[model samples]
Target: MARWSNWSGRQRSKPVAVQFVRSESDAAAIVRTANSAGRTVRVAGAGHSHSPLVVTDGVIIDTSGLAGVISTDAQQRRAWMWAGTRIHALGRALHDAGLGLVNQGDIDRQAIGGAIATGTHGTGASLRNLSAAVVGARIVLASGDVIECDRNRYPELLEVARLNLGSIGIVTRLQLELRDAYRLREQAWQAAFEDIAPQLESLARATRHFEFFWYPQTDMAHAKAIDETNAEPVYPLAAEGERCAYSYEVLPNDRPHLHTEMEYSVPAAHGLSCLDAIRTLIRRDFPDVRWPVEYRTLAADDVWLSTAYQRDTVTISVHQDIAEDETPYFRACEEIFLNYDGRPHWGKVNYLERETLAKIHPRWQDWWQARERIDPRGTFLNDYLRRIRPR
Candidate 1:
């Protein structure tokens, strides 16, 4: 068994033992061994999480070796990929097969299982979290029993398991819903903070996806609009503006000033007003501030626990330099965020505890109940999971 820890190095918890289960039988055997010994077990993937969900003093199953895509059903609009599959590799495979993920997060290094477990997502008014795209999954329960989960089988568990946070069991296989691959046309521009607010709603409606970034302490902002369109003929650029759509030289690789970020998803109807108020509060009240304020949008979906469950949303992601303590800044932002009925992303840093988060997520209690059923002993649980969904 290989050992691992999360990205931030904030909290470290090691397992009592570790094992690499290459197959279903191997996973089953490992579970049986743990059950017999009366020990808890958890699955560890990319470990990109900032939270301590993967931390455990018990048995840990490393799924890195369980790699490969099992099958694809074009007619069914689905493909079965192994749990260890990383987003970058999976995207390439899907693209080669003329299918692509419905959407993807900014970072592509996370494995499928972990992403689904934590509900990783990207921004777009028409997109939902990655977990929402899961049609089925093969999970290994604590009892060493394996089962297929979907709307038809284990219907109740299926809903919660999509974003199970690894509480239910180790997800070994995933059946994803994909669409025909398409190219995205992206446009970038700068705008004033006040000016952006009025056009936000219109811009989001006009584009397939829209994102904005504001430099804190300054009124300057940058916005990007991406739209899906017919494949354009591959042509050489006239030797001026970097020559091509996918050319790396055309993209800026420069890193921006680092900052402590706190992002929140607010209902789309409050998009302009919320952004406006936040900008005003930060600029007028906190003049010494200097960080980027970013925003993105996504369409509503059926994922019960998704931030965009039944409402189109605008995500306001604010960044503050690492040198600055974010307490006061985030405190100010939280007032506006909460006033707009915002839901913070699970993976990002935030201060809201479980009780308050529960109100924003109406299904929090139900999902917590289902999580308890699968991990009654808190085998796969961690401090963050406990905080958000305490048993």
Candidate 2:
């Protein structure tokens, strides 16, 4: 089978010709196939990432066939999903059953397997990233063995697997904690960028899902509020088969176009100042360029490496039309995030190396150690792991 390693059809790296592996047993068979052939192996879900997380020259195990909703334990508020299930499918299925994930990122096309591996998150003042909801997982080791791990069974491995970044092993299944079905009343509007800093924190506290976007060189900002309340709620439930109109489409309907974006999570305390700094720099240096700045809020989570690990966060996402030169603006924003100890979302573009990533993550050492024990030969690693834990 032909396996192409690419992201969103934008950037593509080397091809790791691969075949679909349907189940844990099928994954084991693929491992045996690669091992016997003396070829390295890697596993990828929907290939939604912008990074080279799965750029391998050897066998690539396609896990989409390993799809299913194993079960849901309402009492425990947990659900078991196969690794390759897409986020949209999972969300719709769960919603139909009167259940929903605690939080979900804007795009639902990413596979659950890939989302958790890369620390993908949705905006919310009270919701954590998807990975943090993972209570346990079924990972296939390099030795062709299936191992079920959790905080108790393999506590060490569980710590690593929580945000493993596809470095440790091939995750075949995931056990996630679920929340009661909820509705999000979305309010989209424009606001002045200067006025957002002081009010950002208070606004997050008032809403459940709040995200906004800022454009470079512009003082204008676009914000969305997805709050929960029994009061008169607007924006009725999205109809079946209707796709969510993303920020880009929602704003400037006549001039919809692709855009480049970068997102970061700052400590709830540092949020205001972070936004202030960006505005100050933009207003002072690049006042001519204009795009709306987007912000979103998410609740705290318990995962060791989650963005909202211990503190609440306000995610400020900046975007520029794809046709525009975004490198300079993105570079400037990266510097701001670095100064504020910002944690970049894994699926998005970030220039963080292992040394830098280690500083932001206290569990980095523990995760790498466990990964070594699980995949000593680095069977599941790609260029991304090399960046995170260079040889």
Candidate 3:
């Protein structure tokens, strides 16, 4: 049997066939043929998502073949590319065209399609996730029909498609709103947990981009803040110096290690309180766990399924080495996430259920109706989607 696994190796699949698709017609054909043969279909991106969204025993379509920049609207500051384009590749291409993505998460190895589908983001109180840059998309539906949607045409579809969790349909290409390329300067520092924890909100609000990783073993927080700059580019190898470079260069961290992670977004107003609770929980029981707890922020967005939907958000991420049993550590933090009205990142580890999801998202039913209309029989639905997706 042909097998597939994610970046962290936490989820795996033994698909009957792993098909690499190049064109929209080919993608549509595969979906049609799979449904006719009664085999569920799921498309594979960079295979970085931690969730079991793509695990299936049927056919898995690889989007790597369908990768490249299609065109750019330099005048409108917009660009669209085959959804399979990797974030790092896209950044280089856009930078060549004098454009850059507005924000990015720590890892840049993910395909742009997967990044947008999962609401990937970076740290900034005013910056929205990569999904928010989506101005439109070309989707190949479960029925083998292709359609386009944006602010002008099929506006409702754009709303749900912004962060569809790969359940709506196969997005062949995405149109993104770009910004004139910009540079950023970074300053790294370390301090005791007491020093940063109390001033977390002020620090986040003051910096253009800010985040900290609290190392549980030493009770020290390694903090980094980056701000827009016109200064000469300076690249440093040490933690105490200042580094200045393009936004893409300074924003993402290449986390090369294999690890299982869980992240949740809570209300911005309650960020410190939530962090305090998590800090207490870690110190009280799981102090021996050697990984750090991550803290970041995201501005509000209108995407119906977005964690920051209708409110500013503070995202907290916890990680464990791949070899460790993450169950006990993750479950305990999950209780705190749930208590603070936290919404889990779709691409990460989460235990959210249907009833809980509906209660949290005001437009939950609307998103489901839109998805069902696009793929009524769930030809694209997986076990994970079925569990959390509203009926």
Which candidate number would show the highest TM-score if scored against the true structure?
3
Please give each candidate's TM-score: 0.86, 0.87, 0.97
lDDT pick, better of 1 and 3: 3
Task: Put down candidate 2 lDDT per residue, 1-391, tens digits, no spaces.
Answer: 3547454444455544677888888888778777777777777888877667777777777888988788887777788899999876786566555567877777776789999987888776667787888889998877788999987898877777778778777899999988766654456777777676567777777876666777655556677766554443234434322214322112112223455567788887787788778777777776765776556676777676776767777777766655677778878988998898888877666777888888887666766777788887777777667667834
**TM-score (C-alpha) between model 1 and the true structure:** 0.86
Q: TM-score order of candidates, best first?
A: 3, 2, 1
Candidate 3 lDDT tens digits, 51-92? 898998888889988888889877799998999888888877
What would the per-residue lDDT of candidate 1 be over residues 156-247, giving only the tens digit for each residue? 77887787777788888998998876666566788777787778778888876577788875677778776675646245632322223321
Off by over 4 Å in 1: 1-3, 17-19, 35-38, 233-260, 284-289, 320-324
lDDT against the true structure, per candidate, is: 0.74, 0.72, 0.88
Q: Judged by lDDT against the true structure, how good is candidate 3? A: 0.88
Q: What is the overall TM-score of model 2 with all chains considered together?
A: 0.87
In model 2, where do residues sit more than 4 Å from their true spots? Answer: 1-5, 229-259, 283-291, 320-326
Off by over 4 Å in 3: 235-242
Q: How many backbone clashes does candidate 3 have?
A: 0
Q: Model 2 — which ten-residue stretch has the worst lDDT?
A: 246-255
